[model samples]
Target chain A: MELTIERATKLQTKPNWSDLTFGTTFTDHMFVMDYEVGKGWYDARIMPYQDLPLSPAAVVLHYGQTVFEGLKAYKDDAEEIFLFRPDENMKRMNDSCERLCMPTFDGQFVIEAMKQLIEIEQDWVPEVDGMALYIRPVMYATEAHLGVSPSKQYRFIILLSPVGSYYAEGINPVKIAVESQFVRAVKGGTGAAKTAGNYAAALKAQEVAEKEGYSQVLWLDGREQKYIEEVGAMNVFFKIDGKIVTPELNGSILPGITRKSVLQLLRHWEMDVEERRLSIDELLEAAKNGTLEEAFGTGTAAVISPIGELFYKGEKTVINNNEIGPVAKKIYDTITGIQSGDVEDPFGWRVQVI
Target chain B: MELTIERATKLQTKPNWSDLTFGTTFTDHMFVMDYEVGKGWYDARIMPYQDLPLSPAAVVLHYGQTVFEGLKAYKDDAEEIFLFRPDENMKRMNDSCERLCMPTFDGQFVIEAMKQLIEIEQDWVPEVDGMALYIRPVMYATEAHLGVSPSKQYRFIILLSPVGSYYAEGINPVKIAVESQFVRAVKGGTGAAKTAGNYAAALKAQEVAEKEGYSQVLWLDGREQKYIEEVGAMNVFFKIDGKIVTPELNGSILPGITRKSVLQLLRHWEMDVEERRLSIDELLEAAKNGTLEEAFGTGTAAVISPIGELFYKGEKTVINNNEIGPVAKKIYDTITGIQSGDVEDPFGWRVQVI
Candidate 1:
């Protein structure tokens, strides 16, 4: 795959890394590829990150025909840049593309393009604990058509933002509101895929939770609003009787990469991992009886965010009294170590960028 | 609200209304408004229909923090423009805005701006058999932030597209594929809101149905996947044993205005309109034994589309054999007549623009 590079017209000098916010500051360059019905995906390139002039009738702006994937690049003690299981992200992106009717590109081509862009913005990758470059690959329908059907032309673009630790307090647990009134994903929906609509749909509940002083909203199954699905943007897991329990691979819950990795690590550590239909009643009962040792959410940004308390049905149930559980701490350490290359990666999940 | 009207820099001289697809053709002007956190929504104007220059880091392009409402302006026999329940559409738009964490605007302000735009593009309203000027009111996060939090800045836009008759062949019934694999909206999600994400999530399944030789996919309820929820962009209803049955207003289904109007019309006609949960299995049983009289989808664009056949699990269930049912014909006639000013709108739904 040939690449065409274009440097930004302007670049920041002496960029401040101390107060950098996640997703606010972006790198100077962005990777782009075009897809058309007759020619398929082509014209892959890394160009200067700038404003895109879009027709008023573009499908994405109107119909929300967009999908995106998020992963991060870590700078290790050896001063090397590495991406953790980028191919997995690429594969998941393809899955999302198929669901959104977007043209899929080769995973290797995207990975290579990402590495090139990371190399160009290597200096922007902050060298701080829990700080790394967050890579975002977005595919959108760019065709200037107003039809409700899928677009014939599309654009795949990648951007990078150096994000600090998602939680400012660093692994300190958070209060999550169990929203029985609102469900995030329904069965046979686009909840499993990393589509734009899933996130957009959750913003309202998130806003309500934030107003109530909660970090995120824990969504239940849409039909009955009883089964535990996910927490806003992350997949959820529970620890009952020292057994790792997560919701089954229902079409509604996103099959997160970090979630998969955590399950593998638990299995490798000889801990029993059970993927089943986890219900809210079961979790509440377990927590009340002290059988639930821990509860956490997993995603690319936050490896594991411990759930301190759950507000559900007008009742506040403190799972662990706003403290991070041991299992959560252990998983966080193991995953962060693997990502930073401080520990031996037995599964070979990391791919070196430079 | 002070208005700024800018005529289009260029217009399609030879307008092709004959080959006008659904949303492909646009008028010469559009309505726009801006909203910032501190100042609220302001700067309402009618601007030239042109490209929207968006920053690379706009939040709508990433998080899908957007919502929209659809209505239409119809030209009567006297060449007068009339809007059907535009205030209802405005209220629904703000309801969606609240769900999406977007700033709300006054209904009158939006209506006033829309009236100006309609006056500018009054000629675009087709005078053919079943044609109207489609109005799309959209609100999205325009902040240049990368965080997943609610945006402090937003853009509310109104676009006009002159659409031809939804059914070119005079409203022939359609075939629907029962999608047991994909779900559109979940409880506690943005299912009730007219949000962009919900539509984005349905594109893939809609494509699959088309490939399977169906016009649309019938979405089942998220939890059970047994209950009928909706069809692509439309609320569904079935006539079973002289009763009009539709899914109950759980938090997951959009409160379609057309759906509400139809139910009212049915009730006015002395038909029993029951807004309750209708199971797919029950419908199938009814279809097998001839209890199912007719099935149709209701939305803004396609006022009512009769379902000719239902394909579920590799079985074909014909509904009235491609003939529009008696109840459906009445609904189609009453709604289109009121919209075209051929009948009196007793509910005070019509708002004349010119």
Candidate 2:
């Protein structure tokens, strides 16, 4: 539990905060720890961000044995910083580690480590309206072997990237295409885990969707290809018959932290919210019958991505006249407000780091 | 493709050939190539085997945008090195690239590069009866951006390892457990691709099966969990009522090179062989009636692995009295013979590299 600190002699010039893109720039330092079967996790330190020297036979390169988590640190107008539900992210990362056969750590310990990292990089956090410092915590197998088994050595790293909008069209409704040819995960697969392989398997579908004039692809279940699962990298929600509905976590869907917060916030606000299996047929029928009110995607990157149009089976359905719905706007405003300390934190989800 | 060559001044001591394990040892030289979005694949070179410097934000480290292929080079009594169907491995690697959204290379050109690499490292190939040099060709995203998309930069590397046995009990009957709880892949997932993500997802189940006294786990279809998909990382086959049967290519199973060669060789011998869906219930029923004669798995690593026992649903069925079946023995001997140049070259598979 001893954490060593190293100060960089010289820091690189920071990027222009006003014209920031997603995940392209890094802060001055990074948090790192090494794990060996006999030595355990040691050498916890924050050093200058530099290149990682790995063997050609590292398991993470050849076998994809990696798990990652994403969260954000926001700066209020008064220059105070807060993290939105980072505990949930670390807990979920452990679940992902268990699923992917990687090692896990105490969630609280990692959260404290992350707090120190953010505090050191406090200058990187933007005080703008819709911007924050994105925190990426990743653990990967570093064993220099090509065997098809779990690694005996690992490396845990935490990186900080100052980002603006996740997508190019920031805070705007995005067009989505329902994908039937490719699947993200199956019931017995690694869908529930926020691991590297799940995202790697999704690139082809996402590329195709982008080429077809859609911002993201809506994934269907692998078993039937009839039920909704996720939208691109986000958890999807639908407003049907004046009630909020989303796909239940059926061992194959990612349990998004933002999706959970949205549900909790909706319920706390006395809105009708339910987690159950909803078929594509039912949703499309609701859209045809004027019962589909709004549809949006929730994740740490975008927070609330209002899905304006859904194109499935060569047909397009526009939701809420291709405009942002009141529910989505309110959810985004409330969550972002809480993160910036502008609104009351009734759920205690925000962690004031500094 | 202009290739560059860099020789090492001091060579590292090679491992003992007789005491070799899979993918643990490396040769003196490795083939490498780089790819950029607009520059295409360039900088093809054979350099000293060294550590690969990568950024923490490399897409392969976080999102698993990687694809790899495995083959072997054998040296006969005259120290003549030969490669078996390397073209197929490169072609399949391209297919895997398409599935994982990675950049593809000219299979023929890559094969030529591999031949040159083997020539330069000819002294490293093991000259034993049961041992040879294992060749690993892997390509991964090298872009230091954190976005969940196809990387703009990549690195393809070819590594050689002197090895002996792929499994601990080499050439012996291996006990396998039928896994119904955790599935490997479905029709629409990355099941057919030789990518890192698929292997990462299978480790958990493999670890569980190994702890339960089985060498590997037999994966069923991810959708129904009924029909058998694969045994461990290899393709499975069964002899029932004097006919050879294997699960058909349903898009969720890897099309193993050895499995294809086995089918072709069986047909050349005028044996009754078929590829179709075979359910576990039917297999167990046959075992109950004494008609399930023999079962085996096939892959490049093991060549032909005889399955002596199958454990499923609290039931254990011994195949062929827990011994290497006659058919499996013949196929293994034939394939290994062709690879070593001891047998007649009917399929024109073996390519002399040195």
lDDT string, candidate 1, A87-124, tens digits = 99999989988888788889998899999999998987
Give the poorly placed runs of model 1, Cα more than 4 Å off.
A166-170, A319-322
Per-residue lDDT for B173-281 in model 2, tens only? 9899999889899988899999998999999999999999999999999989999999999999999999999999999999999999999999999999989999999
Q: What TM-score does each of the candidates earn?
A: 0.95, 0.98
TM-score of chain B of each: 0.98, 0.98
DockQ score of the complex predicted as candidate 1: 0.68
Docking class of 1: medium
Top TM-score model: 2
Q: Residue A293 deviation, candidate 2, in Å?
A: 0.7
| Model 2: colliding residue pairs | none
For this target, which candidate reaches the highest lDDT against the unseen true structure? 2
